[model samples]
Target: MAESPKRDTRDTTPDPKGRTQDRLIEHSYDGIQEYDNPMPRWWLTTFALTIIFSVLYVLNIGPIGAGKGWIADYEADMKAFAAAHPAPSGNDVSEGALLALVGDQKALAAGKSTFDAYCASCHRQDGGGLIGPSLVDNYWLHGGKITDIYKTVVDGVLAKGMPPWGKSLKPEQLTAVVAYVVSMHGSNPPNPKAPQGELVTP
Candidate 1:
């Protein structure tokens, strides 16, 4: 008996689903085949829109004006804020201004708290000299004037082992702490360490 030849199974025209199965012959692996399918209309439209949006965004055109990027807007806002709230001035940190705060019990308390947190380790809790110089004594490593104290606290005497507090403390806090140190004068705490600098009246 004669055997019949097998017919080819590959489609040569568009399928019922509208896929051009004839021209879409992808490489076969094992016994499986693939079709070169077209993407959905909605997906293609979205992809094109995204590309357009990227170009527009980079160019800053149409609805997006030039120099209107997020970073530019942020910088503008920061500049305006800085202009509105300027940095503190010398008068703001003056001795008289700080002394006035001494009269405010609240300010003294705040200053004491700040000193304890930062200065107490070296100066001791009672303002008696330890690793750092005493605040209660008439003598000072630096000048004892209110302005001098303010500068010392802000600039710090690095050579003498004190770190500058200017960056760490706010303007008001610096003034308050200086005021508190001034208030401690003549307190004469126990175990008072020997004075190290010129005598200046409080």
Candidate 2:
């Protein structure tokens, strides 16, 4: 039978700190001292949970809206919906007179501004021709009535360089401009351009 090891009893007594030698709670091997402090209540709960939740939340919400290009899929679906249901019409005006209101004073002023800005470049300040025909004279390339003039404005003779101003000017404003034009007939300006078309009575 093997002999039992000898026990050291001299160092088994309590130390000067009043704690029992058995309850010292620490034993240093090299240079590190470790205490047995209990885990804090709030730190274990709030801090630990917050860190864990943040990692999970980012994984679920990031990188193209939760997964592989889900945002692109959503945009494509929206475009398809818009194509399926187009925008509705907005204006509530009669087909023909729509252009007549362009003759209104306020509308005429607006049309006049548009006219001066555009037509005046060729027709000159007083409606006499620089390159285009005179607008102030009784002779007209098209008819001279308000409705006829509105048609001429809207459906310009593209064969000639005159662009259809209908898309640019509202019908009411076009009418006002036509009225102003008719009002200028036989104006006999000091520098009237030579007449070209057959004279037509309004």
Candidate with top TM-score is: 1
User: How would you encode candidate 1's per-residue C-alpha lDDT over 89-185 as one tens digit per residue?
Assistant: 5547655777798798998999999999999999988999899988898898789888899889988889988988876788878888998988898
Tell me, by lDDT, which candidate is best: 1
What are the Cα lDDT values of the candidates?
Answer: 0.81, 0.64
Clashing pairs in 1: none
lDDT, candidate 2, 1-202, per-residue tens? 5534533333346679865454233444455645445578987899888887677665554353354445555687889976875432243334355445544567567667767877777777677777778887777888766666667876677887888776566655555556556555666777878886878775
Q: Return the clash pairs for model 2, or none.
A: 101-172, 102-172, 102-173, 102-174, 102-175, 102-176, 103-175, 103-176
Report the number of backbone clashes for model 2.
8
lDDT score for residue 169 of model 2: 66
Poorest 10 consecutive residues by lDDT, candidate 1? 1-10
- Model 1 off-target regions past 4 Å? 1-91
For each candidate, C-alpha RMSD in Å?
10.9, 19.0
- Candidate 2 — what's its lDDT? 0.64
